[model samples]
Target chain A: MNRKVTPAALALAFSTAVTLAASPALAAGDKDKGDKEKCYGVALAGKNDCKAGPGTTCSGSSNRDYQGNAWKYVPKGTCKEIPSPTSPTGKGQLQPFQEKG
Target chain B: MRGGGAGAGLSERLRGAGGLTVEERWAVALLDPEAPTPPDLTSWNGSDPGQRFAVYRNNVVVSLVESLAQTFPVTCELVGEEFFRAMGREFVRARPPRSTLLARYGEGFAEFVDGFPPAASVPYLADMARLEMHCLAALHAADADPAAPQVLEAALREPECLPALRLRLHPSLRCLRSEFAVFSLWDAHRGELEISQVNPLAAECGWILRSGLEVRLLPMCAGDCDFVEALARGNSFGEAAEAAAGDREFDLGRCLATLLRWGMVTSVNGIK
Candidate 1:
């Protein structure tokens, strides 16, 4: 039972698809539940969500293992759980941390 | 490494150690109004290298000022053109770009505006610069496919499980909280919608998120902003909810639904 898509519905679907398919990598999303997060000092280099800091000419150009300024979208609970070798305390921090390495 | 090391050693001997590297002297010469070109300008083919360097200086200053104008169009519009260029000249002199990327060069420009005594009359100028610069950053940030609405719905349907699962935000999502109306100020500065009207005194909270082709500077409240920041920091649903709780009525369900519809959420978990 396939009816022809109305222009309204067609446009809606097209827009939705376009919206979803835009940027293929990096960055964090936010909604009210407070469940989602962008944790800094946790992203792997070249895999940072965004904000790689000064001297980084490109989006994902994190220099070290866990550059403090680079962020990754992680679950809120997982932020502290994830281990950062360079972190001052060797643990994830809420704010950007000065890395050892 | 060999070529770079050799070049550095020669440059040091030519320009003297701890004085100014060849490139540093060139940059300094570019800013100087005097037409006397540094000996480092030997690469230039012109007979009058000093004159040529002056021409190059003018070109560099123009280009840098133009880039600043583009990055902070509103600030340019707010301050007269002559005045803006003067300010741009100072900014260039003080904080030259360390990297080749022009887009990311002016990260400190907003802070510069905040401390600028000339712009003291318009204190919100700094926040406006911050917003505009953020908009630029959002444009270049990595993108992501938001989680399907159904996935979010399913998570919401099970309130208990929601606390355990992590949500990922879209790569282009950027949030700003300011003591000034950033969005409307940005709106007023747009070329097509040039309606120069906004309240400078009122505090504002805003989020910049990109859809398919469009980037939105949407107004949000502090409560919701806190909620989003918490989540972005890797807070769990329950923890975020508690942190987001305040005098304001934070409709978690509706807000989450809007974010899903807008394609701001990347996934229900790290699976994405």
Candidate 2:
């Protein structure tokens, strides 16, 4: 009980404690559940069971293994899956790509 | 307790006031807006007026030329570095920066390049500069949401029966079609590709769009290129697409996928 704690050990223990305490709060502060899911959705889509990163959540896209995670501060409607060869087709009408001015 | 009150030395009194003489004030304003114009050259700590003026002049010239260099990289590349620096120096002396933002400093440089005698060998260099400026502007243009694919899908379902369908484009999309392969040249230069392997004669219609955090360049087909040009002119999606599809190579499916992938489509508004 009287053993001395070295400065390095104390620092490491302090950081670990801080991380453990802060993880839940950080997760809760991430407001958009959809974005969190989408950010880690890529991993989910690949059928790999991965823990959601801090401030992110994972959700399933139309593809079973494909998951999407959205970040908290990213505005709504900003996050979309990167178009790959296997991405879905024929859901909506064909529209011309709008060029931003 | 201060005895030398009235004439505590003119220098000390003037120093306290921090006032500048007319000539010094004029020189400082001419050199830099922020510089304090001191009253007399005799009062200056070390440098004489001529020396100070030379330093200021050099700084102003160098800064102006640097701004031009950023605005016209292709023009510089074509002329070679040493020649470009000389040309830039001449340009700075002829026309100084009028605005604080260096980005807008070279609005007239394309015309300047066009008229320069030495640059005559490469007639298309000026056009290349113009195209680069457009790309720069487009890359920094305002951000907008791509139109929801669901809404566009609905519109396409009733293509024949639909009224006006207005399409909103992302703010950062731009296209430039040119007879020369200026796009390819720019691409090679920007991407740091080997210039020897590139064919300057190859023509390309370049489209630029920002997806997520990065800006990308797309090679446009004849019909899609025409369609984007029409949209830029404020044509409705239906109109622009029809004009585009009039070309035999226009494939609706391919265009839609490209648009979606690029995050170029913003909103589809159907007429009430």
Best by TM-score: 1
DockQ scores for all predicted structures: 0.02, 0.01
Candidate 1 residue B21 Cα shift, in angstroms, is: 2.9
Candidate 2, residues A6-52, lDDT tens digits: the string is 33432343234223433544322222344432222222231222333
Worst 10 residues of 1 chain B by lDDT: B1-10
Query: Per-prediction TM-score, please?
Result: 0.66, 0.58
Off by over 4 Å in 2: A1-101, B1-43, B160-163, B191-194, B245-252
Give lDDT tens digits, candidate 1, residues A47-98.
Answer: 4666787765355567555788887766677887878877887777778777
Q: Model 2 chain B: which ten-residue window has the lowest total lDDT? A: B34-43
- Model 2 local distance difference test score: 0.56
In candidate 1, position B30 carries an lDDT of 81
> Would you give me the overall lDDT of model 1?
0.68
For candidate 2, the per-residue lDDT at B226 reads 73
